[model samples]
Target: MSLLAHGNSILEVEVTNISTHGVWLFAHGEELFMSYDDFPWFREVAVKSIVNVEEQSPDHFYWPDLDVDLTREIIKHPERFPLKSKSR
Candidate 1:
């Protein structure tokens, strides 16, 4: 499925792979791995829970399911947000 943002702006995220553990999202010409271990809300849930993802801008992503959002900069440089934890 496709993801749309405010003003119907289309996000570039794509589901490259899905398994019982989690989903792999491809965006911004890069591959991002997300696991249920860290994102507990997605555990045992279907892929449809993704609902939608909004780019919002060039670097941010908004996920309606987990009620969570993030940005490319943060994913690329997670050290900046030391308080945050990555999936094990």
Candidate 2:
């Protein structure tokens, strides 16, 4: 037997993993990695702060626990954005 999405779509973002290098997130059917090199805020934060995640919009993500927010594109291609800790 197989399960379906039913009436509502699951459009939520979540922090899947946290490693010495960085963090992993599962969202929009994709697993995105955020390296501490690029996103330094998560390097020293508590595990609870890292795990809390929310998808405010289709392409936007928000982490209320740590007051951190990011976009799906940025998470995928961080090199494009040169300035670190940029204002989002």
Candidate 3:
């Protein structure tokens, strides 16, 4: 029998590393890379602001400090969706 849910344990989404090129996020047993080329809002941001990320849902993430909300799909395949808002 297959249980409809995972074991009762909390999963945390966090920024594991940050570099001039991008940031590494650890979530749900996977490590994801988000580059400044696609995620320009993160460029030049403080470490405190960059690390302040929240997982609103299993596939949705929000950075309250940056006022940004992104989905796993968007983060993984940024090239599929072009036309970013002009960075100031």
Candidate 4:
């Protein structure tokens, strides 16, 4: 089924696989693995947390449940953005 058919924006996060760690999403052409280590919100979430995943375009993914969104470019190239607070 298509991700757009899921209805919920956050629930649209496609669930490829579920394990004790977290869920895997297949967005665009790359496979994004969201682990609880980085995303603590999903650490204890049930399997139903991820409703569906829709491809807004060729590089964007919409999650209707948690209102979490991401882009393919960012997942593929996270190093481009430094991990530092903007206050500095």
Candidate 5:
């Protein structure tokens, strides 16, 4: 037997993995990595907070628990946007 998906369509964005080095995000059929060195906002957060992610729009993600927002481009190319704030 096979289970069928039901209800409204789910957003295709999520935190796939969190490692000692960084976090991995899967969005819109693409896997993106955000190193702690670059994206420090997630470095010291709780696991529960990190997993609570939402896709506000195409390629845009928001973490209500952490109040952090990011896009696919930012995750893929941190060097392009070089303004870092100390992670609390």
Candidate 6:
């Protein structure tokens, strides 16, 4: 007999860890880190909000609770997009 596949295998992005300094994301078998210095939006958000991530598309992630959207490129090279939103 063949093994069954996952119900939602395409859902590949997730928040694996959160610390005082940053959050860790796991996507497509690779782990990416986002520091508070680069991703300040997540620094002060609640854990629930932070983990509530959705993969809007390939390489794109969204946090509905925080109303934040990010792509793999942005996370990998934050310097390329320097104008961040001012703190609320």
Top-TM-score candidate index: 5
The local distance difference test score of model 5 is 0.85
The digit string of per-residue lDDT tens for model 2 on 1-85 reads: 0112676556477778899999998876799999999998788888988877777778698878778879999889999976777
Q: Which stretch of 10 consecutive residues in model 6 shows the poorest summed lDDT?
A: 1-10
For model 5, residues 1-88, the per-residue Cα lDDT tens digits are 1112585556577788999999998877788999999999999889989888888777888889888989889899999999887988
Order of quality (TM-score) = 5, 6, 3, 2, 1, 4
lDDT of 1 by residue, 1-88 (tens): 3555675855477667777876666887888766655454545555666645666666677777756677776555655655543432
Every model's TM-score: 0.60, 0.80, 0.83, 0.58, 0.87, 0.86
Q: How many backbone clashes does candidate 4 have?
A: 12
In model 4, how large is the Cα lDDT of residue 62?
66
Worst 10-residue lDDT window, candidate 1: 79-88
Over 1-88, each residue of candidate 3 has an lDDT whose tens digit, in order, gives 0112366545478889999899988887888999988988888888999888888878788889889888889999999989675553
Which regions of candidate 6 deviate over 4 angstroms? 1-11
Candidate 4: lDDT over CA atoms?
0.57
TM-score, structure 6 vs. true: 0.86
Segments in model 3 whose C-alpha atoms lie over 4 Å from true places: 1-11
**Residue 85, candidate 4: C-alpha displacement in angstroms:** 13
Cα deviation of 57 in candidate 5 (Å)?
A: 0.7
Query: Tens digits of per-residue lDDT for model 4 on 5-24?
Result: 45754333356887887667
